[model samples]
Target: MTFVHWLAGQAGQTFASACVMTILVLMLFMAMKLYKSYRRNQTHLVLIIVLPLIIIQNGVLISLSDPEWSASPYLHIGYSFVSLLSFIIINFVFMKLYTGPASRLKGMPFFLMAIGLVVVTAAQIAYKPEMLSGPIAPGGVDLLALDFYGLILNFIILLNLRGVDQRINYQTSLIVYFVYQLSDMADSYVFHGEKPMLLIFIHLLPIVYYTLLFLLLFEWVLERLMMTFQSSITDGLTSLYNRRHFNKKAEQLLRDMKRIAIIFCDIDNFKKLNDTQGHHKADNVLKQVAEIIKEETAGIGTAGRYGGEELLGLIAAPGVKPEDVAEAIRSRVEKETMVTISVGVSISREGTSIAEIVSQADEAMYQSKTTGKNKVTLHPSVSQKRPRSESEGSKRSKQA
Candidate 1:
């Protein structure tokens, strides 16, 4: 056999293999999605699973049908219709899942659909009946029309991706799939009947596309799990570490540090304020106090919401006094919010446990509350005759 004949046979076999592989992978993906949807009771996953099945059918029909039959205008039109309809359905499903019905489309999808319709109609009008007598040829007007149709379908899919949550996966998969379709369309024209080497490479595009999509999906699932773990440790009301996380992290900090400080802060008259100003205003005050604490303790330590109307700060920096950190936070809360915070400082020494440090700070904070509403106090063991900073004294006098 001539080289051309051998090359053609190899190309044909490769194309067949590629089609089979794509179908199998797609079916597996569909089954996976189906199981997930069933477990989660989410009906929306049905559309994505079904759409791929339709595309798989199209691929199978194209691979097995006679070239002349596939090239016929009626079959060509039917293929385009089925492919376009699948994209439309899948696009709607994605848009509904991500953006909701309110912003599903602002006319872009419909406009693209109209454009695709015009291209297909124009292709049918420009078709020559005489061309049917010859073997399948490249660059026909009908092929151009189909290419345009596929392009519009891809554009619609991309449009659905707008406003999707960035952390969620599948954005990359959608883009890869779009590029794969376009490359496949272009390859049909570029490698038709000759160039077996290039055709073999083109045939591998689906494998690459699906593999990348699988990897991206795995990454997305991992990200979601991480986010869930973070949320568990975080305080939803203030976006700070919760008491549970604070306990765990403070223990870790103490293990690595020779000197550490714990500052406990309680909002003064918070219950009265909540009763008078309402829960909404009380929430705002809590959020503002949390922000102040976060800013003051950043880098020097970790801060968290210990409980209602109370916040905790842990500072492990050498040469840093717990009183100074407490005063900084007390001053900021007084200046920034309508309410005042009483802060208590406790210094960690050799063989001191985290529980002991927290207890000392809490007692000191209670002393501030009992003596005066908005003052910073230190546990008697760590208290010294050191004069308070001028700024801290001034802020306290203003509160007085």
Candidate 2:
């Protein structure tokens, strides 16, 4: 139960360091993958380079945990230098990523931090050159020098950046790392390894710290993947599902239920709207109509952008009428926006393919467009559906 034999001893410290090293190695591989995927992004390139340097620091700490080993004073200085500077620069990389990947990070903050790190490192050797004789562990006062500066630097960066950037996703990681650094600083100045429990905790902090950092990178990767997926499945302008994804949803719905419906909407005189009001204005109108369709179909079904000025809704709720949904879409477009729409709805039968259903809806929509604009029409094959007049749809919308 006690840590005296294992945790407080060299074995425990080495084990902890080994865990940190393992986490660092995994982070390195992730960094490599990111850099490989985005070769042009200098931020990833910086991560790929610095992670290996930090990993080597952990490897050295593991090797030197044994009491029998001795290292030169220069080696001690190198250890602190590598650990401090690499992590500080990596924090700069964090800021760069938040700004955007393509942004060059040659700002005043980076320049000042670079100069400050060099100055602190120089002061460490100047104040007390790693003694030529009796190479030993950095004492309490020694930690107050460069290591303390590193801690303060990180704290300041996070404090200021928290105000400047609202999208720092790795906040938990930063907090854990702050506590880890604080604990290490506490061990050096307060207990000085006299308390085995605190020493064990200090040794374990690296594992917790590095593990949190690794997870942060993993989370960032997942977020990027999600954004890519959303971009692929959704229209960039209206943010509705694209034609391909809409069809996919239709197929999936047809499989799950015995009946489904497709409401196809086409904006009236959309080419005139685009030509008269310009692209930006026409895009707003299209987006507004898409929003009406999405709102009317919420929960019962999904809405999508089928093409230019063309949007769709797929209804799968049992007992819900497709014609009613189509009318609501048409009435809303007429009342709410600068333009009106002609809509046609087709319900899926036992043997209808998604293409066939969409074709039927399109056919019905063409009939409405030819007869009158701003109307709802049902497929002729649906015996019970009565095509709603523009006045009836408007009255029903007013009633609702």
Candidate 3:
């Protein structure tokens, strides 16, 4: 029995050493990453976990020096407790920032956690005044109670985010956090002393799973940030380039001296539709119509909703006549759906300003509305007399 106990202690020391090395390496990597992106939230999160781990390393080393301290068993459990607390606090802060809402608990849990940590820290101090002299008090009820409470609270915080559809990355992190704790707990109590080799191997399960999960969460957060950056330049409802993006696109076209066609479209009686259909159905219709126009102009131009019922498209094809592009939009608007729309087409080869082009298209669209609706009118510069000989121009002009 003594021989087996000696062997187990030896393996525990090795495992503790490996964890310490891993902690050092992670800290170095995190510090380097922080130097590159000072404001990165991830750098801050890594730091939060790292701080607790550093404290844990000190505790582990002390416990290791005096095997009589029972540090072998408590080393993993102690750090896991601290880690679980830190993770919960960090995750809660993230949730509040993301949703911009105060946490529901009114700070009671936080108070309890602080008290528990204080009790544990004081217990550690009593157990070891000096690393040179290993002394352990049989881990009283208060000590065990504090550790168990931390674990339960961590689990509660995890469960709270389950049904909420916010910060999916954080939610995933919480799940990984829970799994890691569960596995660590299992290996510690059930497998640690019985089979040192198997316990060491099983210990790696949580680490690998958590490492992979953490990487995936990093990717997800990065992707979300990119999406938010892109969304700032886009319209929320129509998924079209917003006025800001349109201005930027126009400026680029002007710089390149590219010929462009600007078409303005307004849902012919949109106000009436909204009044009749109610806001909900009206919103659906607007989305549907916007999608139709988007599909029609796919690959040919950039389409955007210019707020409310107004939609705009910018087509840049240097030699392709502006009037021809306008005609295409006009034809698509007519045949695409049963919903009627008045379209104004303006083609500019002179590298004109976006404002001037939009004004011209707006004027033409209004003219279409005044002249009995549901048709396309080309800008006055592009043979605006309705093709005196082509009657289809005049024929479809009255369909609206």
Local distance difference test, each candidate? 0.68, 0.78, 0.60
Q: What are the per-residue Cα lDDT tens digits for candidate 1 across 288-314?
A: 999888888898898999999999988
Native-to-model Cα distance after best TM-score fit, residue 76 in candidate 2, in Å = 1.7
- Write candidate 3's Cα lDDT for 1-400 as tens digits: 4644444454545554565456545544644564455566653555455545654654554464355655434554465456556554544544433443343434465557666766775665477545324433333112444445556766777666633335466566666656655554555455544665554444444345445434543554575678887799888877778887877876676566666777788877778877877887767767767776676566666778777888887777556565555555555555664346777877664647778888888888887777766666787875546821113743554232
Candidate number with greatest TM-score = 2
Q: Which runs of model 3 end up more than 4 angstroms from their true locations?
A: 1-210, 318-328, 331-338, 384-400
- Candidate 1 similarity to native, TM-score: 0.72
* Each prediction's TM-score versus the true structure: 0.72, 0.90, 0.59
Kindly indicate the candidate among 1 and 2 with the higher TM-score: 2
RMSD values for the candidates in order, in angstroms, are 5.7, 3.4, 7.6
Q: Candidate 1, clashing residue pairs?
A: none
Per-residue error for 265 in candidate 3, Å, reads 1.0
